[model samples]
Target: MEPGAHISARDNVVKHDRTDFEVPLMEKDFAELLPRGKMPLANRLPVLNLFNQAVSLGGLKAAGAKLRQDVIGCNETKIVVVDHGTGLPRSCIAF
Candidate 1:
């Protein structure tokens, strides 16, 4: 893991069939991509800082399917998702 080394979702997910404007999923190349099949504007999720923090913590697969979407977005190259999570603890404020 060098400074400029590459970080990718390759180890976590696999490369499968998808279109130009899509990201590859897991296994089989491995996974699924729910309808509403558009990668949300990266800034839309609570994941702004620590996305992985909750994307799957609730087991909501589609909302958290970041790999494939990333594969395509990066042109199947680098898998970059700045998931640093805001160190401040957060919870369901109203719901």
Candidate 2:
């Protein structure tokens, strides 16, 4: 669910891009990322939840959504930006 992670659907086509997703449209984005035009609802719901949590957090959510560069824009969702100095584990977290 991160930008540039090389995700593949169970049917097996690779996603076309590696950018953060904008909400409302996020469902659509997830659909597009799938190989068979059939993304599992089970997987999608949690991602939306994550987006909702970010939105509840404030400005960081807005900035994260800004990465979309779309007029539809981001809502209350939070965006986290991190670098090499962040000190968190690289395996379990997203920057």
Candidate 3:
């Protein structure tokens, strides 16, 4: 998937804000995006497992867990979630 594509289980489509693009989320597309040999196997395995679990359980929950684990409230990038259809910000997280 392209950067900036919103993965939401609440919606049937993956939405991209910049170009107002919408596409169906399919297993093939996700499988093709998995990390390959260029990445270390040790690093890749956990990520692949997480990705598979996310696919099986649904995206939002898995993403939330990852965000909570990774976000440390440091002076770095900010992560936010917004209402995709309305373009309204819902929550902001800084790290």
Candidate 4:
């Protein structure tokens, strides 16, 4: 990759408008989501399960999802909450 080289990416971009929202889940829906014996109980666990638990417990927004995307050669982690089909940033604590 050169600094001034011209490159084209047809459909290589994630076109997300402010109206993009993530799928929501609940705690009771966990069993249906995880495969039998597939749910890891090890360190850190899985973010998906934690997400479900949070919404069910009202710790996190019920219509939101966590996103960790790369931006400007850096990792931009944020919690995207659903705001009527729009993805809004609940909080973005960069380290």
The lDDT leader among the candidates is 3
Full-model lDDT for every candidate: 0.39, 0.42, 0.50, 0.37
Candidate 3, 1-95: lDDT as tens digits: 33322444344365445445556567554544555625446523333243454232345557766676575333237776656654445566764
Worst 10 residues of 3 by lDDT: 1-10
lDDT of 2: 0.42
lDDT of 4 by residue, 1-95 (tens): 21111222233245444334445556565565665736656443533334355223232333332322321223335333323222333344456
- Sort the predicted structures by TM-score, highest score first: 1, 3, 2, 4
- Candidate 1 lDDT, tens digit per residue, 8-94? 333434333335336666445212373275656654655322443444334455544664565334433444443323222222222
Say which candidate scores most in TM-score: 1
Rank ordering of all candidates by lDDT, starting from the highest: 3, 2, 1, 4
Over 4 Å off, model 4: 1-16, 26-28, 32-38, 42-95
Off by over 4 Å in 1: 3-25, 28-32, 48-95
Could you estimate the TM-score for every candidate?
Answer: 0.21, 0.17, 0.19, 0.17
Can you tell me which runs of candidate 2 are displaced by over 4 Å? 1-5, 9-56, 70-95
Model 4 worst lDDT run, 10 consecutive residues: 1-10
RMSD of 1: 16.6
TM-score, candidate 3, is 0.19
61 Cα displacement, candidate 2 (Å): 1.5
